[model samples]
Target: MTQQERRRGRDETEEERADRMWGELIQEVRVAQTGVQILFGFLLTVVFQQKYASLSQADQAIYIVTVVLGACTTGALIGPVSLHRLVSGRRVKPQAVRLASRMTFVGLLLLLVTMGSSLLLILRVATNNGYVPYLVTAVILWYLVCWYGLPLWARRKHSSDG
Candidate 1:
C-alpha cells in the first residue's frame, strides 16, 4: 500500500477525504429531508381538517407542538445543503462537513421528537384507551434503539476491534 493509504486507509489527500465525506453527508441528508418534509406537509394539513376542531384542547396543543417540531426538523435537515451552497469554493469544506454533520444529528433528534409527538397525538385521537401514553413511549424507545442505540453499540464494539 502507498504511504497515504497506510496512514488513512485510502490513497487520498485531505481534500479528497472532505469531498467523500461531503457527498456521503448529502446523501444521508437527502433521506432525512424527504421524510421530514413529507411528514411536515401532512402535519400542515392536519390543522385545516374539520376533525381537527373536534380535538380536545390538550390534543390540539400536542398537535401544534408536533407541527412546530416537524418544521424545525425540516430546517435542520435542509441546513447542510444551504451551508454547502453558501460556502462552496471557500476552502473550508472540512469545517463545513463537521458543522453539517452536527446539523444532521440535531435534525435527527428533532425528528425523533416530531415522530413521537405525532404518534402521541394520533393515538390519543384514535382511541380513548389509557394505554396510549405507554404505547407511544414504547414506540419512542424502539425508535431510539433503531436510530441510535444499536449504531452506537456497534460503533463502540467494532472500533475497539480495529
Candidate 2:
C-alpha cells in the first residue's frame, strides 16, 4: 500500500497520531475536570449547612452517596493528567491515550449519576410529591441520550467501520 493509504484517516505517523489524540484528550479532560471540581466542592460544603440536619434519613443517605459519587467523578476526570505525567517519555503514548480515553468515558458516566443524584436530592427536599422519581428518571434518560446515544448513533452511521 502507498504511504497515504497506510495513514488512513490522517497523514500522520503513529506517534504523531498519538500526540494529537493525547492533546485532544487532555483538552476534553480539562472541561470535565472543571465541572467535576466545582460540583465536588459544592458537595463538600453541603454537610455544613443547617438545613442538612433536618433532612430525612433517606435523603441524608442520598446526599452521602451523591457526595461520594462526585468525588469519584472528580478523580476520574483528573486521572488523565496524572496518567500523562507519569507515562510521558515512556514510549507508551498510544496505550496512555487509550487508557485515558476509557477513564474519561467512565468519568462521564459517573458525572451523569452524580448530577442525577444531586437533582433527586434537591427536588425531593423542595417537595414531597410522588412524581420526583419519575421526574428524575426522565432527566437521567435525557442525559443518557444526549451524552451517549447521539454520539454512538453518529459513530455507527457515519463512520467507515461497519
Error of 1 at 109 (Å): 0.1
Q: Which candidate should be chosen as best, given lDDT against the real structure?
A: 1
Give lDDT: candidate 2, residue 6: 47
The C-alpha stretches of model 2 lying farther than 4 A from their native spots are: 1-7, 160-162
Which segments of candidate 1 are over 4 A away from where they belong?
1-8
lDDT of 2 by residue, 1-162 (tens): 765564466778889999999999989888888888888899899899999999999999999999999989988998888998999999999999999999999999999999999989999999978999999999999999999999999987766443
What lDDT does the true structure give each of the candidates?
Answer: 0.93, 0.92
RMSD to native, candidate 2: 2.9
For 129-158, candidate 1 gives per-residue lDDT tens digits of 899999999999999999999999998986
Clashing pairs in 1: none
lDDT of 2: 0.92
Q: Lowest summed lDDT over 10 consecutive residues: which window, candidate 1?
A: 1-10
In angstroms, the error of model 1 at 104 is 0.3
